[model samples]
Structure formats: C-alpha cells, structure tokens
Target: MRYRFESELRRWEARLRDDWYFVDLPPEASAEIHEWADALPRAGFGAVKVVARVGGTSWSTSIFPSASGVYSLVVGARVRRAEGVEPGEVITAEVELV
Candidate 1:
C-alpha cells in the first residue's frame, strides 16, 4: 500500500549528541501504518519498514513510533543532499509499505 503526504522536514538532537532529521507522519497515516505493522511479522524496534520517495529520490527506511501514537520517518543525510531538502521545508513524501 502507498500513502502520500506533505510534511515539514525537522531536525532534532539525538541521544548521541548529533542531529537527526525526520518528517512526522500524519495521524491518519500513522494509524494506517500501525494497523499494517500489527499484521506483519514482528521486527526489532517495532519499526515499520517502507520504501519512501521524495522528489526524485527513493530509499528504504522505517517509521519509528513516537509518543501519542505518532510516527516519524527518518531522512538520511544522503537523501537530504540529493533532494536539496532543508529542515523546515515542506516536502511531499510517498511511502509504500513493504
């Protein structure tokens, strides 16, 4: 299944003292992903694997659960540079459950 949405790229400090980037999934999308994940064979970290496309780039990643039933898609540095996306910029992302 595929879901598309626009979200602002955000950056936050990770526990290791480095910055991490992500795009938060919408609540509805999060619910759908949670439902799909529940049906999959469990994996470590409880993350839902997916293929994400942004701009002209596509990569494999996972959506991590956050507080209050929310999820966030991590944006790697490679993808950010390739897509010319900066934190706080709104970008359209297409996520396909794999």
Candidate 2:
C-alpha cells in the first residue's frame, strides 16, 4: 500500500542527547497501517517497514507507533539536509509499505 500526506515536521529528543524529527501520519493512514500490520509479521516496536519520500530524497525506514496513538516517520538529519526541511515546516511525504 502507498500513502501520501503533508504534515508538520516535529522535533523530539531522546535522553536529552539525540535530536530527531518526525511527521505524524493522518488518522486515516494510521487505520490502514493497523490493518496492514495485522496481516504481516510484526517488527520491533510495531514498526511498519516502508520506503519514504520527502522532497527529492527517498529512503528506507519505518513508521513507528507514536504516543499520539498514530504512526510517525522519522526524518533523519541526512534526509532533512538533503531536502532542506526545517522543524515546524510542513512537508509532503510519500510512504510505500514494504
């Protein structure tokens, strides 16, 4: 399955050391992901494997379940730099389930 949407790039940190950015998938996409995950073998953390595209850059990653009760895609520093994306800026993402 393929899903596409626009979302705000949100910043977060882990253990106050690693800074990360992610975009939350819309509720409709999350619902589809739930069904997709159910029919596939689970990965760690319920991550759904995908190939994500942002701007002109595309990379392999996974959509992770978020505390917000949805799925979110991590936009790595390399990807952010390649795409010239900034936190709080809206970005359109294309995710292909793998």
Q: In TM-score terms, which candidate is top?
A: 2
TM for every model, in the order presented, reads 0.89, 0.91
Candidate 1 lDDT tens digits, 1-98: 78899999988656547768989889998998787788864456888878899999999888788876877888889999999999999999988888
Estimate candidate 2's alpha-carbon lDDT, on a 0 to 1 scale.
0.89
Q: For model 1, what is the C-alpha lDDT against the true structure?
A: 0.85
Error of 2 at 70 (Å): 0.9
Alpha-carbon runs more than 4 Å astray in model 1: 14-16
> Alpha carbon lDDT of residue 40, candidate 1?
60
Task: State how far residue 49 of model 1 sits from its true place (Å).
Answer: 0.7
